[model samples]
Target: MSKKGKKPADSPATERPRPIASTVAPPPARSAPVTSASSPPTAPPKPTQAAPPDALIWFDKRVKITLGVFVGIFLLFVLFKWHYISLPAWNEILPDGGPAKRGLVAGTPKRIRMDDYAVGAPWILSNANTGFKTENEAVGGLKTPLLTLPVKHPIIIFKIGYWGFMFLDVERGYSWMYNSSPLILLLGTFLFFLLVSKNQYWLSLTGALTLFLSSGTVRWSFIPSSMIGYCGLAFVGAVYLLRSTNPKVYIPVAFGLIWIIVSFAITLYPPYQIPMAYLFIFLLIGYVLNERKLVFPPKSVLVKLISLAGALLVAGFVAYLFKSDVDETVKAVSGTVYPGKRSETGGTGFIANWYSEYYSWFFDDQQFPKGWLNICELSHYLNFVPVVSPLAIALFAFTRRIDWMLVGAMAFVVLMWLWMEVGYPEAIAKATLMSMVPTRRGQIPMGVGGIVLLFLYLAALRNVSLSDLKQAIPVWFTPVAIVGIVAFVVYTAYVNINDAEGMLRTDQTFMPVLFFILMNGLLLFSLNIRYRMALFCGGIILFLLPNLKANPLSKGLTPLTENLVYQNVKTLVDKDPDARWIVNGSQFVTYMVTATGAKQITGVKYIPNRKQIFSVLDPTMKRDSAYNRYAHVTFQTYINGAQGDTTILAQQYEDGYVIAGDPCSPKFKKLNVKYMLYDHAPQIPYEVRCMKKAVELGSMTIYERID
Candidate 1:
């Protein structure tokens, strides 16, 4: 039936619609059958074949599964068994014959990392024997907990190393956790860049390796490295959960976030943690804003926000479970004279140090300038982002396109620089929460931000072609930018050279030229999309080469674990687990004793026990200046025995102190000293009433208190 104002097909009133006329007249119809007999008929064009499917497409499920299987096998069978730990530094202290007999598989162990070898690694092993309790009796007794843990603490109850304990026995668990710290950093950094760059493979990889091999990371591989890694994981998991739409992924991502957050917090190194926290907050805000539509869609925004809040709440709850322990720790640490109550007004850092990475390769602990800086503190990442940032800003201005991530990273870096190189008012520092971060520690986040800015700058230029750049940027800008970058590089080098004051070697003088060339090349390559990945690859090589030796590739912990001295000490401690001992002559021996699970009064003290421990040594509190702070305790024989003093204490440095006293003194007995390990024979005659030689092994002797 016909509808209103419409006609049916059979309606007589329906007229045939005429085609719309063309504006130009059509050509006259060709005459029919005009082809000559000799002319061959044109063959119908062959049907076009579909273009071959892209061979370099992203990995499919099958390929991904195969690769995952291989990675798992490699991790379980190979990586976990070997370690890059600097435990071989013991070879120097205990000299195992010669180079051939040394326990190291390859690379020279850094003696400069005595903290890792002498304190951190030993305490980790000691915890295994103590049922993984937070209070390690080996060092500062129940008052000072082991700040560095490879296993779950009884009170803390959570550590990233719990996975190692779940899979391996105590010894192997220590090895696994030690080896995996760097892996965590590498993987987390890789994942962070991958997510931020939208899965730009080479760029992500370069960023990850650059940070992994960075001097600060390798130098402080235990706590700071793990902290950075966990922070990265937390950021990555947060981003994933925020952008996720699947309910199935929500629970897993939330759980991962909790783990990451807790692990990061427990690292407990505020100097690194505070700065990194500031950097991540900026990045997270910028990321959410940049991906607002995807991260906070109208349909799922509430659910995502609730999931994030829930994850954070659960993490906070877990931390609250150990509130008493956390509070006690925080109180003790905050009360310390060295780090506790320490506030910085900034403007203490040297601008030359930013460029010091170039000369840092030649840093010899022995040859390092006196009272200038230590090796660990001198370490920094080689970052040219600050030098190249002006050009990036100009490009962004000319193109009228701003990458919020780049802006966020740049802003963080600028803030850190201002705090480190420019003094701020105390009120401003407190308001900005920069008081907790020292000028040296600010380098951690600043270096990290610089690298992030560098990669983000490259990512921002990904879609901008060279032709587009030529059109968008002025003719004079290129030469001006080039001159500016060179000037910056030269000025930076000049400052560093003058600050170094002839410390740089003859060959190291070319580092600035190389840096300048690389910076110019990076700028040039970034302008063209084709060379972007190439530039990243070059960067990876540049980062990996010099920093490869930052850490040594050592095999097992046999140097300490299997040595006769450790065996003897372990056997002795096993017999009298409650007896408190002392190590005389060397601090390294004290660390060895701590590792043997023996209670030692003279070892690394995480938290000073002023009331019980220090009071016994200094009853009158006259030596509070020496023993009040956290210190690595070392003992030297009292040369002036005629004075009849039981003990004489002096602060050797901020983190160390020396006590010169007779081992048989009444003060040592009051501290519950049962035995003493001496690196040399006692210069004073052993008092039969108080002490006697227990045994002699090689050049070392152990004295047993016989009160």
Candidate 2:
């Protein structure tokens, strides 16, 4: 402190600045302090921050470790799916029960040949086995990785059809491939949420698991028809397009438009008339601001009108093309009875009567009718399993776009119903039954509504909110959930029908009622993530345990002969591409030949046997089952549909390349047939004989077609 007795703190070099002169009196300055050499160096200026608690690296390391744990979980998810869930589901949906269930397991590959075979009428009839028959030929038959953007239209259609067709694997045939569109939409939407959400991992996982466990989704896997899938996909496309970034863009819009047009064509089939789904895209699009006008100067209002008109005109032209094509097809089929009419006489007569009863099913009734003939309707065929419509319908309010769309759908359905009942049909109820479009399937659309609501509910939650008190739920959603619960419970009970313990239960006589009950329960209202996981696991269990348990109703049956008609056709085709064989069975052969590589013969009916005649003939025709009478009628039918001269069965086979008669059947002996051709029958010797350990190649016995 030193110079002139001033302290070091008062020195000019060390002193702080004085306050402003006008505002306050100036402080005096002092001289610097003198030190010997230098005072022990003052400690360096103190750091500004307090020492961090322990090591900051710990927090960072924890974050990294947590991240690593999540990665591990994701890997685990993939592993579970690959090892225990998806792979098995794929296996199940692929062959014996799913994919490779045919008799040609050891067959040699023939070159893939493509063609639009001109099949005029149903031939090679064999409608007996409806179980898990659709083989997803496009996926299974065509050697391709993806279906989109194929060069050929038929191939494209086949590819698109395959995805939808193979998605569901049932006991017999596949549901419409169109349903895949909706499933695809659901998956896309789910993936979008998974990608954007804060808790993406769980959401992503849930999305993946969704396809594996969804019973409603899986139940439709193997339906032979593709119509339902298409209609549902139309809805899916509309929903997806409207929600997309560029609603006016051509890609999705084009797909949507084209699909709608395609949908209309397929809807001609009586079973596919789900008319309630009127395309309400215009209504939805009306809400979107046309970004096109923002960039370009606005055109006159009349230009908009003209554009709409032009678009309509183009659409009309396309419609005309489709109409022309269908007209040509219908011209060929003009004399034939529709599928429903055929069902009545061939085997499904009750189904025909039911559809013919009142044009449409009365779903609002306290109890919807369950008729054995209506094989396609869940109410009848799956009587023991039950039909759960309420569970899906109650979610109408909670679904985002669904409630409004459902309203439109309901209106459309009602309009269709009215048309059937009072407008379209003139002969009281009879005309309605015969001519009106099908529109009573409230289950699928309603089920979709429920699923959308569930998704919304799931998406709206935070991990904390869901974990904590229920206070965070939107006030409006609580009632929705309550309604859903009520609906779900109601439908569950409605569909929860009891099996009549009789010869019915005799086949699998010993299985507990609980097992069946649990299986049914799993199918109904079980779409949660965990439940889906369980389903995947359970499905795996079923595949692994191929128990040869028998149902007593089977009565210890055995096979008498093996009808290799399909195999026989394949052989004939292979022997000579031009060789034609006449099939006199049911509707089963058409699908089998189509799946395998055989062309349809004209001898069969699309809806075969007795059904065809009943459908076309006046109702006054008396029922007769005598073989000679049937033989005469069949012979005439063959002449009319194809060859002017009918080929006599016994005489044509003299060339030795033909087979005739049921080898072990009394009918064969009665017909006085010299040679035998094998066919499938769940009778005493046939079942046992057909099951002989056999290896099949491309040359595997398909069917023994009698010449």
Q: lDDT tens string, model 2, 388-489?
A: 233224332222223232233334434433442344433532432323333223333323333332322233222212223233335565455445444434
TM-score computed on alpha carbons, candidate 2: 0.40
- lDDT (0 to 1) per candidate: 0.67, 0.29
Segments of candidate 2 deviating more than 4 angstroms? 1-159, 162-217, 222-256, 259-322, 331-335, 340-376, 379-442, 453-571, 574-576, 583-604, 607-707
Per-model clash counts, in order, read 0, 67
Deviation in Å, model 2, residue 574 alpha carbon: 4.1
Per-model TM against the reference: 0.84, 0.40
**For model 1, what is the error of residue 653's alpha carbon versus the real structure, in angstroms, after optimal superposition?**
2.9
Superpose all Cα atoms of candidate 1 onto the true structure and report the RMSD in Å to 1 decimal.
Answer: 11.0
lDDT per residue for candidate 1 within 168-249, as digits (tens), equals 7754666666766766776677667756664455666677777777776776654466666677788877775665556666
